[model samples]
Target: METVINLFMEKLRNNKGVGLFYFSGHGVQHEGENYLIPVGASRVLRAADQLRYKAVAAGFVLASMKAAGNEVNLIILDACRNAPFKSGFKGDMIPPGLTTMPTVPGALIAYAASPGGVAMNGSGRNSPYVKHLIAWMEKPQLSLNDILRNVRRAVHKETNGIQSPGYYDELNEAFYFNQQVAVNDLAEQQRLAKEKEKLQRQQAELQAERDRLAGEKKAIKKEKARLQAEKERLARQRERDSTPITPTGSKKVFRDRLKDGSLGPEMIRIKGGSFRMGDIQGGGDSDEKPVHSVSVARFAMGRYEVTVGEFRQFVNATGYKTDAEKKGSCYTWVGGNSGKNWRNLGFSQTNTHPVVCVSWNDATAYAKWLSQQTGHTYRLPTEAQWEYAARAGTTTSRYWGNDPNDACRYANVHDNTSKQKNQGFSWTHHNCTDGYAQTAPVGRFKPNAFDLFDMLGNVWEWTCSKYEDNYNGEENRCAGRKSGSLWALRGGAWYYLPGFVRAASRGRNSHDDRNYYVGLRLARLL
Candidate 1:
C-alpha cells in the first residue's frame, strides 16, 4: 500500500496529463474520515484503532493527488459495501457509509452512493452505478459534471431511490472523452452545454458575492456594538471619577485586616481610589482596547491566594467534590490528562502552597461555602478589582516597574530552575530564578504595596466576572454568566512568560475546566 501511494504521488507530481483513480473494495467511514481497505489488508476489524494500521486514509490520498501538479484529477470509489466487519466496535460506531469529500480546485470525487447509504454492488459483471458511469462517459461532448449527473439520475431511476450516486466537483475547464466524427455537430453541442454551465456558475458566483457582502455587514454591526460599549464604559468612568471617594459608603478609609471566623481566608483592606484601567501602554490585545478611567470602592481581598490548607478546610467541612475530582482528569502545564490534580501536582507542595487544578465553578462553590460559614459576603474578585489590586497604585506594566529583570523577587515564574529541571524546555521564561520550578508556597514572594502576595504570577486566579472580548461598562461591575460563557481569569502562572504577567493581561476558561495553572483568590465586601 505504501509503495502504491508513493507511485501515485509520483505520477501526480511529474505527470501533467489527467489522473484517474478507481478503487473497488471494502471501505469504511469513522468519525467523518473515510478509509479504503487495500486488497491485501487485514479483514478482521474489531476497533477503529486496528483500521488505522490496515487501511489507507482517503483524505491523505486526495491531498497527495492535489499536490501532484496534474491538470485535472478524478477519484472514483466503488467500495461502499457496508459488510464484512460490522461488530464489536465501541464509540462512534463506524458511520454507515463513505462520507462526502470537500471540494478542491481541479478535482472531482464521485461515490457509488449518497453519503451514509449502502450502494448495491448488483449481482452482475458490474455495479449499476459504474455501468451507467461508463456508458455516460462514452457519450460525446458531455462534461464530467454532466456525465456524473446523468449517471446519478439513471442509477436512481433503476434502483427506485435505494441507491443514488453523489460527487464533489470544482472543475473549471471542461473535458470530454470519445470525441470523434461529425466535428461541427459535436462543436455545436459542446457550445450549448458550455453556455448552460457558464450561466449556472455565474449564479453561484453571484450568491457567493451576496454572502461576502452579508459577512461584511455583520462585521460592521459588531464593530458598532463594540464602539457603543466602549462609549458607555467611558461615560460610567467619568461619572465614577466625579463622585466622592467612599469605602462602601463609609467616609473613613479602612486599612486593617477584616475577618469573621476561621472559615474564610484572611482579607486585607484596599483603600478606595480611581485609576486608569485596561492597557495603558497601547500594546495590549483588543480586549484591553481604549484604555479608560475606572474608580473602585474599598473591598477586602485575600492577602494571599487560597492555599491547599484553606481549600482542604472547605472540603472537610462541606464534603464537596471538585469538578476535576469528579471527572477524574485535569489539564496540566505539560498538557491535558497528565494525571495531575490539586492533591498531586507532580511537584512538591506543602499546605502553604496555593491550591491548583480547581475549576471556576469549584472556586465559586468554595466562596459560597465560606460566605455561609463566616456570615459575610465572599466571592471571586471582579476583573476590575483584581487589576486595581495587582497594579497597587502603579502605572507601569507591572506593579514594580516596566523592567522584568526584577520579577524573581516579586513572583515565582518559569525561570532557570524550570529550565534546568525540564531539560531546557520552556515556552517563555525569565533569566532569573525564583527558587521553585512549579508553584511556590503562598506568601513566598514579597507583597505588593497593598500587601497582596503572588498577585501577578503563581497560578491564575478566578474572577467572578464572565469573560468578554473587551471591557464593556457591564464587565466593570460583577457581571453574571451568559448562557454557556467562560469565566474570566486574571494574573499569570509559573509556566507563563513575563509578558503575560502584565497588570492588564486577561485569560478565561470553561467553568468546569480544571487546570494545574488555575486556582482561586477570595474576595469579599468591606
Candidate 2:
C-alpha cells in the first residue's frame, strides 16, 4: 500500500492532470483514526503499536496526495470491511467499519459505506461499489462528483438496507473522465462577450470608487484620531474618578454560563489585570517593541482551540460555509491552490484536533453563530487579552519559561516529526518529540498557569485585533479593532519553531486569507 501510494504521488508530481487512487482491502477505524490494512496484516492485531506502524494511515496518504500538486485527485476506498480482528482488540478500539474521512482539497474520498458502517463484500469477483463505479466512470460528460452520486445511488439500491455509499468531494473545477466539449453558437458567444466586457468595465469603475473612498476614509480617520485622543483623555479621567476601591491583593475568576458542552466551548476564567503586553527582552519582532502596560477586565476564554467536531456542529446547525469553502481555495504550506478549504485541511483531523484553514471572517462568523446559540456574546480575544491570558501572570517567552527544551512538554512546536517530513527544508524545531508531524489534538500537552490548553501551539489562533505597524492608541480597545487590512493571529502553530511560539509573539494575515495552520478560539465577556 505504501509503495502504491508513492507511485501515485510520483505520477501526480510528473503530470498536470487528474489522478485516481482505488483501494480494495480491509479498512478499519481504531479510536477515531482511519487505517488501510494490507494483505496478511491481521497478524499484528494484538500488538496495537505494531499494527499502527504497519498499516497505512489514511491521513498520511491524503497528505502526500495533497503535496503532489495534481489538478484533481480522486480516492476510492472500497475497503470499509468489517473489523476482522474485533475479537482480539478492545470493544471500543475497533469500530464496525472505517471512520468518516474529511474532505481533502482538490480531492475526493469516496467510501463504500457510510462511516462506522460495514461495506458489503459481494459473492462475485467485484463488490457492488466497484461494479457501479466502473459503469458510471465510463459515462461521457458526467463530472466525477456527478458520477459518484450516480454510483452511490446504484450501490444503495443494490445493497438494500445493508450498505450506503458516501463521499467527500472537494473539487473546485469540473472534471469529466471522458472529455467532450460542446461547440458554442456564434451569436450567443458574441452576446456573452459583450456582457463580459460590460461587467469588466463596471468592475473597474467600482474599484476606482473604492480607492477614492479609502483615501478619503484614511484622511478622515487621521482627523478623528486627533479629536478622539482628547475625548479619550477626558473619558479616562472620568473612569479613574469612578473607580471602585478594592483590596490590593484581590483576585477574580469568571467561568462560562454554559457548561452543557453542546452550545459553546469549555471556558476558563481569566482574572484580568495590568500586564506589560509586548516582548520585553528584544527577542521578538519589531511590532513587539516598547513593551507597554495594558489593563484588562475579567473575561472567559476557551480552554482549548476550537475542534473540528465543534465547528462541524455549527455548520450543520446554521448551514454556514467557511470563506475558503465558498471561495474554493485556501493557502497551504506548499502555496495557494484550488480546492483547499476548511473542510479539507490537507491533513486529517479528529474531533478533538484544532479546526484549521479558517479565515478571520470565518472565525467571526462562527463566533456570531455561537453567540446567537448561547446568548452570550462570544468574540475573538483582543491582542492584549490573548497576551494577558497566555502570560498567565508570567513575563517569560512562554508561560513556562524561555527554554526551547520545555516546548514539547507544554506545547507542540515544530519538532522532530516536522523535521523528518521535510528533509530538504531547514527546520528550527525545538528538537523535542511532540509525536505529531502536523496539528496535534487539543490539550495534548500540559495547560498553562491559567489552565488554558493549546494557547501557544497546534494552530495560530485568530484574534479580533487588526494588524498595525506598531502598537499606538489601539491598545485601549479591549475587544480589539477590525480593519479592511490584515488581521492578527496569536500563538504559533505545530509547524513553527519555538521562537515563533511565544506568549508575546504576533503574526498577521489578510482578513480573507485562510491557511491550514490558522484556527480560532473564542473569548466571552464576563
Candidate 3:
C-alpha cells in the first residue's frame, strides 16, 4: 500500500487538479491521529520493520489533501474493512470515530461507518465501502455532498444498516470535486469583495506616514486613525473586481483589472539604507564573510508575504506549471528516510504555512505570474530588500535575538527536541507543527521590530546576488555571480545547527538544488 501511495504521490507532485485515493482495507484511530490499516497493518506505525504496513491512515490523508495551505484540497477515503488492531493501541490513544472528529481548516474527513463502529466487508472480493466509492466517483454533475449522501444510503442498504457510511462526519463542507473552481473564479470573487474594508482602513491610516519621509510633516496618531474612512472608499474601489460576471465577458477588460490592480494590496514600505549583507558572526560559514555594507534603494513590498491562496490565484490565472508541479516530484526531507517527494509528504497546513519545496525559478515564476495577472512588477526581493523588510528595523543579528533555540519559539526551527535536542528555553513557535518538520507558518513567532516574522529560522530565504567566495569589503563594488559559484542563502533551517542563522551569515547552494529548506520572499521596485 505504501508503494502504491508512493506511485500516486509521484503523480500528485505536479497536477493541481482533482485527486482521488481509494484505500481498500482496514482503518483505525488512536488519540485523534487516524490510521489506515494497510495490507497486514500491525498495531504500531513504526517504520523500523516494513513487515506489515502501518500508516497514519485516511485521517492523515484527508488532512493533507485539504492543505489548501492556500490552495483548495479535496479527499475521499474508501477503507473501512474492519478495525482490526483496535485492541493494540497503547497509552494516550483514543479509539477511532467515524461520525465526528475535531475539524481541520480547509479539510473534510469521511469514513465507511458512523463514528466508533466497524465497517462492513463484502461477501465477495471487494469491500462494501469500495464498491460504493467507485460507483459514486463515476457519477456526473453530482455535488460532493449529494454523492456522499448517496454513498451512505447505498452502503447502509447493502449492509442492511450494518455499515452506515459516514461522510463529512462532523458535517464539514464538501468541496465539489467535479465542478472545480480554478484561480480565475476565486480572483473575480475577491474582485467584488468589499470585505477588506477594515484592512484598507488600516493601510489608509498608515498612508499619511507612507507619504511621509525625512523632512516631511510627521503623521499624528489621530490623523492616521482618521483615514479609516478613506479605507472604506478604497475597499469599494477594489471591490469592482469581485462581481461574478459571465465567462463570455471580454477577457481584455478582466485582464486589465488583474494587470492594472484588480486585487492588489498596498505595498509595505522598506527604509533604504546600508547594512552588512553577510554574517559577520564567528559561528557562521566562511562564505558569509567579507562583510560589506551596501546601500539599498527603498521599495514597497507586499504587506504580507505571498500566500498559498494568492499563489493559487496566479496559477488559475495563467495555468502556469511550477517546476515541482511539472517534474512530478517535490524534494522533501523525510524523517527515518534520507530523501522523499511530494506523494509521501502530506500538506496539512493553515492558509499561513510558508511555501516550501519551491525553487528560485519557481518563486520567480510566481512573481512573474502575479505581475501578468495584476499588471504589477512583483519579483523576488533583492538580497538587500529582503533584509530591510525582515529586519523591520532591528539591529540585532537575529530579528528576535541572537539565540537560535529562541528561534524554535518564534519560528519553526529545531523544535523537534525529542528527535533533536531542545536548546531554546525561552522561544516561540507558530502554535502548530511545521508539518514537514521543515517549514512552519509564515507568521509563526512574534514579528521583528518591523512586525515581520520568521526571518532568522524556519526556511532558508533566497537572495538575488550571485555567489562570491571573497567579495571586496565594499559590496557595492562587488561583481555579479562569480564563475562556478551560485547565489547566496540566508537564515538557517530546522536541520542546521544554530551557527548558520546569524544575520550576516552567508552560504550558497546551486540553482538546481531543490531541497525542503529553500523558499523565497518577494519585493517590487518602486
- Tens digits of per-residue lDDT, candidate 3, 463-505, equal 6666556665322322243445466666666555455555665
Q: In terms of TM-score, how similar is model 3 to the real structure? A: 0.44
Q: What value of lDDT does candidate 2 attain over all alpha carbons?
A: 0.75
Task: Flag the better candidate by lDDT, 1 or 3.
Answer: 1
Distance from true location, Cα of 232 in model 1, Å: 46
lDDT of 2 by residue, 1-526 (tens): 7888888788889886777777888777766678888887765554345557888888778888888887688888888865433221311124456887676668888899887666766644478888898988877789888988898889889887567888888888877887756548989778887997999899999989988887898789657744654554455457457756434343433333433455467777677689888987666776786688899998888888999998988888879888888889875643224788867766777898999988888898888888877778889988888889999988888888888766766787787657656422233577555667788989767677787888898899988876666898454453333455667778988767566789888877767777777899988887
The total of clashing pairs for model 2 equals 0
Tens digits of per-residue lDDT for model 1, 1-526: 7578779889768767787888887788876778888875633443578777778888877887887878788899886765343111311135556888685898889999888766776634578888898989988877888999999999999888878889888876876776655646878989988997999899899989988887898799667755754664565467457745435544332223225334346678788789998889766656776688889898888889999998988788778888888888775534225466788766677889999989888998988887777668889998888999999999998887887757777888877666556521324577665667788999866667887889988898999887777777745666565668777788887877676778888777767877777898988897
Give the whole-model CA lDDT for all candidates, comma-separated: 0.76, 0.75, 0.54
Model 1 Cα displacement at 328 (Å)? Answer: 1.2
Best by the TM-score measure: 1
TM-score of every candidate: 0.55, 0.51, 0.44
Superior candidate under TM-score, 1 versus 3: 1
Ranking by TM-score: 1, 2, 3
lDDT accuracy of residue 95 in candidate 1: 50
